[model samples]
Target: MFAPQGPTLRELAVQALSSVERGYDLLAPKFDRTPFRTPDAVLAPVSRALRELGPFDSGLDLCCGTGAGMGVLRQVCRERVTGVDISAGMLAAGRARAGVTATAPRVEWVRADARALPFGPVFDLAVSFGAFGHFLPRERPELFAQVHSVLRPGGRFVFPIAAPARPGSLGYWTLLAFDAAMRVRNALWHPSFVMYYRTFRLADVRAELTRTGFDVELQSLPELGRRPDGSPRCRLVVATRAR
Candidate 1:
């Protein structure tokens, strides 16, 4: 669902046909108006969880679209915050919205690919929001490694992941249909826009994080409540760089 200020159907169609970076560029200004932006509900619990885990100095928001995660980092990190994204348009919107002043923790925006981060051991905390679906399952290792590379020893890479839908549920069918449609679109289109709804699995992600040298833990976001089975409706994956 989108707000009155969000992109029109035609604009969304155009974005879907473009490459990921260019698509995001076109969608940047209206991104926060769409449901695709990380919900403040999720961000709040994640920030609370991170605070319990840290008094971190520096933070990085990987794939920081319009810098929503940067707000969370600002609350948990003490010294500086950096937002790295590949879309120039997104970075521009982020810079405008962030309004980071000299009084706040120094905020920097870098236009760079997440698969090849430019920083090294420079961050004590990192957070990504609603961006993993852009990468294919096979690319997980490299992406996780990139985040690992940028973090200091004992640094954390945190993000919220929702519980998977049951097989016969409406949510399951919706995700399946969305992924199928995306596959069809990618097959028919050029410079493929690679946003899928169901590619990132928590178990697989945890294993990949471990392989990338992170000590993984899952923290239930109880504020979001629980499913009928009693499992958390959402969780925060806290992947810490080995000390």
Candidate 2:
């Protein structure tokens, strides 16, 4: 659900039809008003978890659209925070919201492809929020590798993973239809916009992270609560670089 200040239905339709980069460009100004932005509820708990992990220095926010996750990084990181994304519009929006001064542990933005991140092994922590759907299953290896390459030895890459939408639920059907529609659109369009809600499966992603040499751990986010079956609704995937 979107607020009154958010993009209108027509604006959303236009964005949906455009390439991912262009769509985000058109939507950047109003993105926070929309439901697409990661909420504070999610970020707060994640930040707390990262604090428990603690003492991280430089941090990177991969695909850091509007830098919502920068709040999480800034809280837990003792040094600087960097946000990387492909969309200049989104980066500009993030810069405006971030309001970083010219000081230590300051915020900086980098425009780069997530698959081909442009950075040295200079970060001790990396995080992504609600951006994985843009990547296909096969692309996870390279993306994970890119994140792995930027982190310092014994560094961490972390993010929260929601439980898969249960079969026959409205959420399940909605995601299914969205992905199906995106597939058809990509099949017919040029410079195809790739965003699917269901492509990032937990098991496959865990395996890929393992292959990329991370020691993976899934810790329950109790604040997000559990499901009817008493399983955690959300889990934080904490992947540390193997020394």
Candidate 3:
């Protein structure tokens, strides 16, 4: 759901019809007001988790739309933080929102595709939030490889993954319907907007990370709570580049 200041239904309809990049560009100004933006509740737990795993320097916020993960990187990383994204409008919004103080680490915004990151093995940590759905399952290998290439050996690529909604639940049906509609839209439209909720399975993601040279670890985010089945509601994927 969107807040009072969020994009209107007309605006959203226009965005949904546009290319992913153009759609996001149109939404950038009011993205934080939408449910699509990573919530602070999620960010707080992730930041706490990163703090436990860190004392890290030089962090990267991959696909950093409006820089939500950049806030987490600021708390965990000591030296520099970079927010890389393909959307120039989103980057512009993030830059405007980011009020850099002298005390905080250096922050830079780079416009680049996540599948082909333009950097060496420089970052000690990399994190992404709410942007994976834009990448199709087939593109994940290249995406993971790019993350691996940018991270220093032993550096982590961290992101949170909530447990899938239970079968027959409202959440489950909602995501299923959303993905189905997206598939139909893409099938009929040119310059397909690629976003599918059901595609990023944890098992498959772990396997891909392993194949891409990451030693993967999953940490439960206790602050986010647990499901009735006693499984964690959310977990952080900390994938360290092995070499």
lDDT of 3 by residue, 59-156 (tens): 99999999999999999989999999999999999999997578858999999999889999999999999889999899999999999999999999
Error (Å) of candidate 2 at residue 216 is 0.3
Candidate 1 ranges with C-alpha deviation above 4 Å = none
* Alpha-carbon lDDT, every model: 0.92, 0.93, 0.94
lDDT of 2 by residue, 1-243 (tens): 999999999999898888889999999999999999999989999999999998788999999999899988888887799999999999999999978576567788999999998898999999999999999888899999999999988999999999998999999999999999999999997778899999898899999999999999999999999999999999999999996
Give candidates' CA RMSD values in order.
0.9, 1.0, 0.8
lDDT at position 236, candidate 3 = 95
Please name the candidate that would achieve the greatest lDDT relative to the true structure. Answer: 3
Please give, for residues 1-243, the per-residue lDDT of candidate 1 as tens digits: 889999999999999999999999999999999998888988899889988998899999999989899999999888999999999999999999977587657889999999999988999998999999999999999999999999999999999999999999999999999999999998987989898878899999999999999999988999999999999999999999996
RMSD score of candidate 2 (Å): 1.0
Runs in model 3 with CA error above 4 Å?
Answer: none
TM-score list, all predictions = 0.98, 0.97, 0.98
Q: Which clashing pairs does model 3 show?
A: none
Model 2, position 154, has a per-residue lDDT of: 95
